[model samples]
Target: MRTAVCSGSFDPITLGHLDIIRRTAACFEQVWVCVSPNAEKKNQMFTPEQKLLLVKAAVAEYPNVRAELWPGLLADYAMDHGACAIVRGVRNATDWDVERELARINADLHPGLDTMLLPAAAEYEHFSSSMVREMIRYGQPLEKYLPAAAVELVRKMRTELNREEA
Candidate 1:
């Protein structure tokens, strides 16, 4: 089976992330949506477990896709899983710059693994997890930004957080 690994922090899986996963699933027989940590990103709204739950819910429709937590290096994860490629989503020039460098590093770490950058679809080009988090903090509607499968879970989590804060 041709497997591809798609790694991201996914603090709360957004529709854009789902779109990329769907596209990747079509190209590869097996796709692993690895929810990895980002040391650079602090004050994450969701825990790793919460993130995994959100990812699972967001990707439930894709039979070829599996969501899981990955604590180690992404290159290592790809190598361990025997992934032929590491799939990444590119939304804009800034994303391109960052993903390009990461791809180079991953290539260095796992010479056999190739990186495939899929450009975001027009509707999802502007959506990102960080933006979703900001919307949540400000009490904005999330129906448009998040996947239908994950919107309710995110709303439930928000309600729980509100109760805790109150």
Candidate 2:
């Protein structure tokens, strides 16, 4: 089977992330949506476990897609899973530059693994996890930003956060 690994710190899986996963699923027989941590990011709204749950919910519609929590190096995960490629979503030039460098690093780590960059669809080009978090903080509706399956969970999480702050 041609497997692809899509790794991200999906604190709360957004529609844009889903879009990339859906596209990747179409190209690969098996796709792993790995919810890994970003060491540089702090004050995360959702824990890794929560992120895993959200990712699971967001990707439930894709029969060939599975969500996993991988704390180690992405290259290691890809290697262990027998992935042929690492799929990444590029929304703009900045994303391209960053993903390109990361792809180079991954190639260094796993010579056999290739990185596939998919440009975001027009509707989802502006969607980002950070932006979704900001919207959650301000009590903005998330129906449009998050996948239908994940919106309720995010709302519940938002309520819990509100209760904690009160």
lDDT of each: 0.91, 0.92
As a whole number from 0 to 100, the lDDT of residue 154 in candidate 2 is 85
Q: What are the per-model numbers of colliding residue pairs?
A: 0, 0
Question: CA shift at 96, candidate 1, in angstroms?
Answer: 1.1
Model 2: ten consecutive residues of lowest lDDT: 153-162
TM-scores for the candidates: 0.96, 0.96
lDDT by residue for model 1 (59-143), tens: 8888999988989999999988889999999999999999999999999987878999999999999998889999989989899
Please, what are the lDDT tens digits per residue for candidate 2 over residues 53-153?
A: 99999898899999899999999999999999999999999999999999999999989899999999999999989999999888898899999999999
